[model samples]
Target chain A: MAARGKVYLIGAGPGAQDLITLRGARLLAQADVVLHDALVTDEMLELCPRAEKILVGKRCGQLSTAQQFINKQMIDNALKFPLVVRLKGGDPMLFGRADEELRALEEAGIEVEVVPGITTALAAAAASKQPLTKRGVARSVAFFTSSTAPEHAEHDAIPDTDTLVQYMGGREAIATAERLLAQGRHADTPVVVIENCSRPDQHIRRLTIASLAQGLGAAHGPVLVMLGDAMKTRAHQHNDEAQLPSAVQQLSA
Target chain B: MAARGKVYLIGAGPGAQDLITLRGARLLAQADVVLHDALVTDEMLELCPRAEKILVGKRCGQLSTAQQFINKQMIDNALKFPLVVRLKGGDPMLFGRADEELRALEEAGIEVEVVPGITTALAAAAASKQPLTKRGVARSVAFFTSSTAPEHAEHDAIPDTDTLVQYMGGREAIATAERLLAQGRHADTPVVVIENCSRPDQHIRRLTIASLAQGLGAAHGPVLVMLGDAMKTRAHQHNDEAQLPSAVQQLSA
Candidate 1:
């Protein structure tokens, strides 16, 4: 049956179009249909000029295309064209809901391949010039999603570690920070909130864990929150004030 | 005084040339001198054909350029070339010793920028079509290094919850598995070990946490081990016998 169409789930990386992997970029360029997320930038879309582009991004309480609908669209498009690109933000495997898409594609007898990209955590860490793991600072690195199911969140407790990165934490940034503090993470632990990371319009604010709950009200767009001693170490080495804009500075003050 | 040259710490992703980000790929092409690790593939190096390629990779117990020597070479190169790319395998901020190199570059009054790439953890997980974080399965994820200071290993303990991804666990794979089991991880916890991930020579095997200690004797080259319920969920969804090669059959047997 037309050799069974193949679907490529590709991570677009953080905002910078060049941050996308060569494989992902090539797939976008060659795909018959490209389904992308809201976080993807125009620069990334330009790489897939020939493909039919469809925006399937979801924002908080927005009239977003449901995940099931996107999966169906991929299957439907693949039937017509052998190549389909399910473009996602950051690394497709990292909190990108790739598993659900994979299962949907597989059930439809569509072949699937995944190409990894730089996740926002790493990109944000890079933009801040912070090593997530250092010799004397952070020995362990933890990743969590602020949008986690309540049951999973309750069962999967945050460990008392020196490095913690929270993904998709824009709306619930304050609540996530508060929960960590309640879980015994030090209040003064250094925290970095990066918005639109790796993009030209990227915003980064360095603050303490205790201040993060209050400071986050000033942030815009999907935020990535990095906490622990590693943040403090990076802040100590770099100029924190230089990175913050006047608006954020006023909020922090 | 001439404007101080800059060093770009770029991640080459996992072995695959196309897997390197477009930005990272561009940087590699423009690099005046490229210092790469042993794990970096020949394909990735081709992007920087005009640049002077230096091998600063660390091999276990083998005579190689010391970190100190490599640091010195970067400083010396910065004096001549306006741009230098310190290419590393996977994400430079993950297990990479970027901090040490950054310190060396900064101390010499050279500017440094880090460009993150897809780490093996994400690459391996993508290859297996498994999400590192799944709803109700894995709420948190942790990346641990088997290559660590003995003092740190002795001082801090690995977390029991969350999905644990271990890097460079080739020789110590069994011991690390044993330690996880000892630390209250379920003996039957699912584990996926990928060797040479994202490369054309990539090899993957699945086993239970209890079986990992015995199964690891056959693991080859810079293995990445992922353990937790998310893996178990993936194992259950796929036909284990059909998906896994017979090479791993002995472990379960």
Candidate 2:
């Protein structure tokens, strides 16, 4: 019998291919099989061409693989392959349903290791030149998502923290902004909506609670909403001219 | 005159040399000068052997480079070198004093870019096999630190979130636990203390809010405290044996 193979549950990081950790990249290169989420891009998969690729895609509002099926696939693959990888789009511990997968793997007696990756909140902050935590302004940050699985109940309540980051937040920005307003946050509390963070076509829009409540135009790709007083652009930032668009332009040139 | 150098404010990640992002590592390799924080390990510095390294050490209770001096150094290097890297310990956006440095660089007319890294909270969660956010049990997570600068007033109030991860929390974990207990959190709320996360000598201790209030034993390196129901190990995890030590032993063997 073949030696019991191990599984690596890795976070692929925000959209950029190179945003992945060197450790994760090295594991991907050595994996005999790779199961990746839907949000993971083709460029990222290029790092593991030798592996048998499986798409266990899970995205909001789209038909995708079941969590249980994904778990079973991981167990089956671990038995067959020397190395197996389950790659999630962002940090696996946050909103990634890592608990269910971990339990399943443990019950099957398959050794599993989790490799950390940069979460989108941090990536969005980097792209927009906004620090989620600003001294004397915002000290605590809460990351939450409005989307829930069919088996789970949806929560309309907002997180009670200094800064709030909402994943899959494109469609709910208006409602979230209104709720923040009702919660007594200042009308001018800064809000940043990032679409396709870290991707080549990433777009960042800077607004305030009041303006975001008016509405966000159509957003393509994954969207993240960051709202708080800490997100206000520095007094000397010269507006959004120097943010994502300029960075992309400079890098491309 | 030398071309104006752009400064990349990169997060060195949570101690492990391979944990740095591919983008960050690539930039470090091409950097002309690297100004790294005290928490950055020497193994990570080996990635950029060709670059001139400056240690802007800033550990708690230790004499270190002033924020202003560090900012000036980045600006000066940007004017002289083609690539300047201001390497930080974790994600630069979270509790990393990035605002002051960003402002200073902007004031000096130097371009700056922020690269996200795996924060200690996420790494600790992964190392302990505890998800910071769990379905139903935890919908939100907060990261904070009790170690405040001497010039700033400390906040006695704990953050209101489903899960809380405290950075530089070893010395004050007992005080923090007491505050949490007083704030109506259940005495049995699970807590995990991780020291030297992601490093070879990393250690993880699991306890409860009541037990944590009794005081944590002496810790040898940078410490992180994670407290919440979501941090509780799964019932099937068979105690802490499957957590870190066994993994280390297996890998070493």
Candidate 3:
């Protein structure tokens, strides 16, 4: 029998291959079988040369792999191989629906170790030159997702904080901003809409809360909306910085 | 003149050397000088073979490096070296006070590139086998700290959310819980206090909001307090896992 296989649940980080930790990379290199989400890039798969790569796509309620199916595959793979890796887009511990997978795995007597990765919010912040938490300016950071089952809408509303980072936030920016405005959020709070963070073709648009509530044009990739008074920066950075089309020329935070 | 050095604001990850990203490790190996925080381990320094390693320790309220001093050193080193790394404990974008350094560097015409790292909250969530955000259970997650200067106490109150992770939250656990309770956090919400996350000597304590409001004894390392309704579990998980004294013995999230 295959030595009572164990599972290593890994976070694939934002997107880049090198962005992954040496620990995560090492686990991928040794895994007998690897099951990854759609967000795990092709370049990352190149690192797992000998492993059988299975794509369990999870794109938040669209045409994606069912959570139940993913869980069963993980169990079956664990039984067949000594080292089974379940790699999620970001960290497996945050909004990754890991509870169901973890519970079923543990019930089947499969040991598990979680490998945390850099979340999308952290990556977007870095790519956009924004700080999630700054001294005196922004003290706390909150993360939310706009994609929620219809039944869970009430709980999915964005929370009030010094900074807000929203994942899968593409068409919901207007509604989210309005909700915050009703809750007394500043109308001039700086807003940053980033599409496809960390990847080569990244686009960032900066505006204010009032402008975001008005609406935005279509975007290219997965969207993350960042809003807070702390996001305001001088419109004209030094010439050495990128001269993006939608650059926000304001005072630095 | 030497090449105008750029600062690679790298996150060293929780406590483990292997947890640092491959990008961060590569930058360190190529750095001419590395200025790291107190939380960065000596093992990480060995990654920089020929580079100058300076410990700019920043333990909360302890005798550590001042921000202005660290900023000055970064600027000074950038003028002389080709690569200067500011190795932080977690992701430089989140609560890393990177804005100060980034602004100072940009003002002086020094270039900067940020390489995100896994934050301690993500590590604590993984180590305790808890998820930061759940589907129906938790729709959002927030991060804050309790070590605020007296003048900034007003914004220090806990924000209402499904999950809360507090950093540098040592003796102030009781106050933080009380503040949340006062803000209408359920008295029965689950609480997990982690000390020295992701390290071999890690310690964890499981309690309820009521008990946490009563306070905890002194701890060994830096503390991370996680509280929310989503954290409620069976209180005792299977024994096959690590046998830490206060380990959370329940199904993983």
Candidate 4:
């Protein structure tokens, strides 16, 4: 009998197909089957054309694959295939509910390797041409999201760090800004919102905490919110692309 | 005369050569001159062997390149070459003095692009097979370094976040543990120290905050310290590699 196939949990990186690590790209090409997240772009899936593709992520309204079912699929695929790939958007270590999947696979006694990908926060920082940490101005950076796990009760306390990057900052973007403001964060703290980062239609909105608390138009793609004084654009640098309006037209409720 | 060369600030992810982003590798191959940090591995430099390579990073006990001199080198090279690459260890935007270089380049009207790489924190998490953020236990993660800028007066406050990853945790690793313990963090909080993460000689040390406070043998390579409840190894998971002692022999001072 063939030994249980090893599973590779590879990060697809932020939106751009080529942003993935070379190791991730190589493993994807060799995979016998790939179970990917909703945010993994179709272009990324094309990297492994020979492999069977499964979408396990829950889109905004789409019926999402149950965690248990996805775990079962990985185990079942490992039994039948030589290489199994569990592809997640962004680095698998953060906000992806990777702990559950890793625990499930561990119980099954399947060998697994995690290939890191560029997380959205870093990509968002790159897109805005702003470093998340600046010399004396900022020294620490925190990555958090308002989205809570089904089993966990949400906490109101925000992380006290030098810089903040909120993933999945859709409806909660304004709420986050308000809470930070209430926590005495500067109202004029710079905020950079990047939607569909690294994609062809990527859009960047540069505003302030006070302006963000007032409101930001609805976004169609995944949104990442970065707030801190370090995000302030340097004087005399002419970055016109970030000043332009969002390419994705906002739909009214 | 050739148009002024655009500068690309590419991240050489972790310590591994294959960990670099595809975009970074592609640009690196097309570079006419590459100025890289001291931490970038020789294998990564092989990607741009055709291009002139310059070591511009500060190594301990060695005469280091001045920030202004490095900035001037990039500008001078950009004026002569079609493609100039300023390669940095890990992500350029994290602890690297990228802002100074970016400012200098911008002032000279040179086009610059930042390509994100997998930061050492994420790679350390991957090396240890521990997720930085968990559903209920850890909802936020902070990345900081003890090293400060030359001009900045150091502050004593540690970020108040669920999970903390400290870069360049050389002599300060124990000091960080002591500080965290003093700040009311549980002494039993799990800590994972990764030395030369993602490299062939990579080493992982797993212990508690109290144990870390006691002492850790000196590390020759870059050391990253991760501390949080989320770093706890799952009960059923039998990860033996992490249990193994340091791969690199510790030198007694």
Candidate 5:
């Protein structure tokens, strides 16, 4: 019997190659066959030059059908390769449909382990020099999404949180804002829209809940919208900041 | 006039040296001085062997006096050193008191920037093969703490969230559970307690809101408690699993 292969579900972090963990980078470098998502960076792929890189990413709107196919391909790869890696955009456990994959791999009698990576909201906070939590101001944070598998997407009530970061929220900002307002979020709640967080081309747009509810123009990069009082400090402070240091300059350069 | 120094507030990540980002590690290596917390690992300090390392951490019960002192020290260091790194335990933006430091640095006309790191909850999820968010099961997640500064610590209401993760929750598990229960969290809500997450000595414990409210034993290491229905799947699945692979053995090795 060929040795039963094990699969590693890895988090690729947000955009930057340097954001990936040393363990994750090491695994990618030595992976027998690596299956990556649509958002995995090319710099990360360069580290895995020796591995067979396969793209199994589901673009927006590609839902359960692609997910089921990815699950099947994962099982097949685990049986053939001693070390198989299924790399996802953020922390595998968060909205990456990892439970389905984990169940499939475990039911097939394959060993599995997950490697965590930095998620995008935190990356957005770092890039903007803001925090998701603050003393006495904003003590808790929520990460949610207005966007879901198209089949399951609906107008769900936005839960109450001190700091709320919504993934894939750009297109639905108007609806999300309406839901939040209906759910009792303050009309003046601070809102920040971050595009391509951590990348050199990242953009930060600040607005109030009312303004965001009115909606804005379309964006090109991956979008995240943060809503809460914790963001108020950043919004107010960014206005007075005039000069960027050499490092930050290079970041936006 | 001598140029003022810049402070880089970098998150060292959840106890693993390798989990620290490439950008974070690079900043550490080049930092003129490094001030790390008690929760920061020694392996992380090794990365900055050439820099002067300062231990300005305040253990549990060490009050706001030390925090004020830390703020003063940070400002003083910025005046002398060209590059000062304030290495925090997790993402500085989350429960890390970064706002006070940012304000102090900015007021003193010194430059500052924050680098994000993987937080403990995400690390715990990765280590336990669980996730902070799921599609139908958990559409939202929250991060909070009961162990605030003594002055700020009170019986505050737990924010309504699908999933909740608490830092320094070991000593306050009973109170936290009671608070959660009072705040409308279900008595049967699943709970997972992770100790010394992402380190070799890490331990994972499972309980329910009711059992957790009854109390658990003290831990020698830092503790994190995760609560949610999203965790229900993992809690059920772990009951029957007994076999450990060689790879897992190496994890304990």
Candidate 6:
């Protein structure tokens, strides 16, 4: 009997190739096949030059391979190869649709190892030099998808937390903001929408939840929305110019 | 005037030293002063031999340095050296309390570069081979801290999500579960608790949210709790007999 192939679901971090974990890099180097997502950078592909690369990406409004089909392809390939790398943007486990693939692989009886990466939520916040959790400002963090199903929206309720980070929210920014408001979230809630995070063209906009829709008109590309009292902290700090150091002012500008 | 020092807020990722991002490792190698958390492993310390390694850790019950004091130390040390690494376990923007330090550095007219790391929330889920999000299973993911100040309990509420990862919730497992239940989360919500994630003695337990507190009794060390419908997908796939090729499983296992 041939050795069954193994699959490594690796997170590629936000965009910077160097942001990838050493373990993820090692796994990519050893992989026989590399199946990557849309958000993965080309530099990440360079890490697995020996591996057969397959672009199994899903872009909004584009005709893409079904996720189930992708998972089956990975499983089938793993059977022939000893190592398969499912490289994803951000952390594979966090909103990366890794579970379906994991189930498909596990059901096929293939062993899977997951190498975690820096998710966009943290990367965006880090890029902006904002702490997702500040002692006096934000005590909790909430994550949701602006790409939610309409039925789920009508039936399910939004959870409340000090801070909220919405994934895949670029197109539905207005609807997401409205739903958040309907959930009793503050109208004046601070919102930071980061688009193409960690990339050279990364763009960030600060707005109130009430004005998020208006702000989205100016935002280009995929977005991750951060909302909470911590947003207020940025404003307060921005107003305290007397305390701000020159360097800090330059960075903010 | 001497060149002002810079601070690199780097996330160390989970316990495995190799899990650290390439940028994080490079920063560590170049650090002049490395102020690390308790959760950082000894293996991670090896990357920064030239630096003055300071342990500024805060355990759940142990006496710890105040965040303000840590900020002061970082500022003071950066003044003496051109490079300081405020090394944190996982991504600095996440529960790592990076905002306070970043604010302090900026306020002092120092340059700060944030290099994100693989957070424990994603690492724990990956280690468990469970997906944090699954198609049709979970559309959103949330990371929360169950560890809270006693006084703030009155106002703090655990929000609902497709999946929830709770950091430092071992001590408050019962209270955390109860809080989630009170928030209308189902009692049978699947929950996976990982202790000392990515470390040698890593332990994982899968239970329902209702039974989580009682199920986890007196377990010591850091704990990460993942709860959601996506977790239930694991149980459904458990009975499937599709086994990976034996050789691959043996090597990976």
- The numbered model that scores best in DockQ is 2
lDDT of 6 by residue, B1-253 (tens): 2677878888898777788888788778878999998889998999999999998866644323567778888899888998899998888888887767777777787777777788888877777767777767776677777445677764576766778888887877888888888888889988888887777667878799878858577765688888888776464344211332232333345
Candidate 3 structure quality by residue, lDDT tens digits, B40-133: 8777788899999998856755433487788889999999988899999888988898888888888877877778899999887777778888
Q: Is candidate 4 or candidate 6 better by lDDT?
A: 4
Candidate 2 overall Cα lDDT vs. reference? Answer: 0.84
TM-score per model over all chains = 0.89, 0.92, 0.91, 0.92, 0.91, 0.89
- Per-residue lDDT tens digits for candidate 2, residues A1-253, read 3487988889999877788998889888878999998988888898898999999856644433487789999999999887999999989999888999899988988888888989999999988889998877887788987745523423456767788898888887787787787778889988999888888778888889999998887888999999898898886763453345343444335
Report the interface RMSD that candidate 4 achieves against the true structure, in angstroms.
5.9
lDDT by residue (A146-173, candidate 3, tens digit) is 5555555544557767899888777877
- Badly placed stretches (over 4 Å) of model 1 are A61-65, A147-156, A233-253, B61-65, B151-155, B233-253
Candidate 5 chain B, poorest ten consecutive residues by summed lDDT: B236-245
DockQ of candidate 1, scored on C-alphas against the true complex (2 decimals):
0.42
Candidate 5 regions with alpha-carbon error over 4 angstroms: A147-155, A234-253, B147-155, B234-253
Report how closely model 3 matches the true complex, as a DockQ value. Answer: 0.48
The CAPRI quality class of candidate 6 comes to: medium
Candidate 4 predicts chain B with a TM-score of 0.90
Instruction: Tell me the deviation in Å of residue B91 in model 3.
Output: 1.3
**Local accuracy of candidate 6 as per-residue lDDT tens digits, A121-168:** 888877766778887677678777743457666565656777888887
RMSD of 2: 3.1
